[model samples]
Target: MTVTLKNGVLDPQGKAIEGALGSLGFSGVGHVRQGKVFDLELEGSDKVKTEADLKAMCEKLLANTVIENYTIALD
Candidate 1:
């Protein structure tokens, strides 16, 4: 039950920032992709609750709801 940045999504912000940095005389920088990861240590939490909590977190805080995306892993 993880969500991550989908392939083919244009990362304009990342590209712009990379471009700016390169223009500042810092070359050899390219291929910028922005994404997020969430690490959770559940204290033996139930599966349903964990999923609900994760979903809520993504909907509320983890994700941008506009541009940025996120992914969660149960490790």
Candidate 2:
């Protein structure tokens, strides 16, 4: 799963990264947004139920829904 701040939210870390990249001679870099990635291994094989569980996890704890968005990808 990937978690990221929603648009229009303040991203101080990302801004810092952008400035660092500029100082490192990396040009044309802007609007860098930082995020998180999570990898979980579950015992279920049900796609529907697993997806539901993942979404629930995100809604309940994995992400701050008011300021961030989470995406789940199963493979």
Candidate 3:
């Protein structure tokens, strides 16, 4: 699963990275957004059930639904 701040959300860390990049001579960096990626290995074979369970986990703990969005992928 990948989690990232929604549009218009304040991202201090992202801003800081942008500034650092500019200082390092990287120009034209309009905006920098940072997010988290979670890689999980599941032992289930039911794709539907696994997706539902992953969504539940994100809603309950993995992500702050109020300010962040998450996308899940099964490999």
Candidate 4:
């Protein structure tokens, strides 16, 4: 699962990193956004059920839905 701040939401950490990159002589870098990635191993083989459960987890705890968005990618 990946969670990221929504567009138009202020991202101070991203901004700070962008500034630091500029200070380090990395030019033309802009609009940096930060996010989270979760790697999980589940016992179930049901893809549909697993996706549902993952979405529930994001909605309930992993992500702040109001200011963030999440995506689930399975491998």
Candidate achieving the largest lDDT: 2
**Candidate 4 local lDDT, 1-75, one digit each (tens):** 999999999999989999999999999997988999999999989999999999999999999999999999998
Against the true structure, what is every candidate's RMSD? 4.6, 1.0, 1.4, 1.1
Please report, in order, the local distance difference test score of every candidate based on alpha carbons.
Answer: 0.70, 0.96, 0.94, 0.95
Query: Better model by TM-score, 1 or 3?
Result: 3
Please give, for residues 1-75, the per-residue lDDT of candidate 3 as tens digits: 999998899999999999999999999999988999988888879999999999999999999999999999898
Question: In terms of TM-score, how similar is model 2 to the real structure?
Answer: 0.90
Per-model TM-score, in order, reads: 0.52, 0.90, 0.85, 0.89
Number of backbone-clashing residue pairs for each candidate, in the order shown = 0, 0, 0, 0
Please give the lDDT score at residue 6 for candidate 2.
93
Model 3 poorest 10 in a row by lDDT: 35-44
Per-residue CA lDDT of candidate 1, range 1-75, in tens?
Answer: 344455567877768878988889998997767565556777766877887788789989777666556665665
Runs with alpha carbons beyond 4 Å of true place in candidate 1: 1-9, 13-32
Question: Whole-model lDDT for model 2 versus the true structure?
Answer: 0.96
User: Sorted by TM-score, highest first, which candidate order results?
Assistant: 2, 4, 3, 1
lDDT of 2 by residue, 1-75 (tens): 999999899999999999999999999997998999999999979999999999999999999999999999999
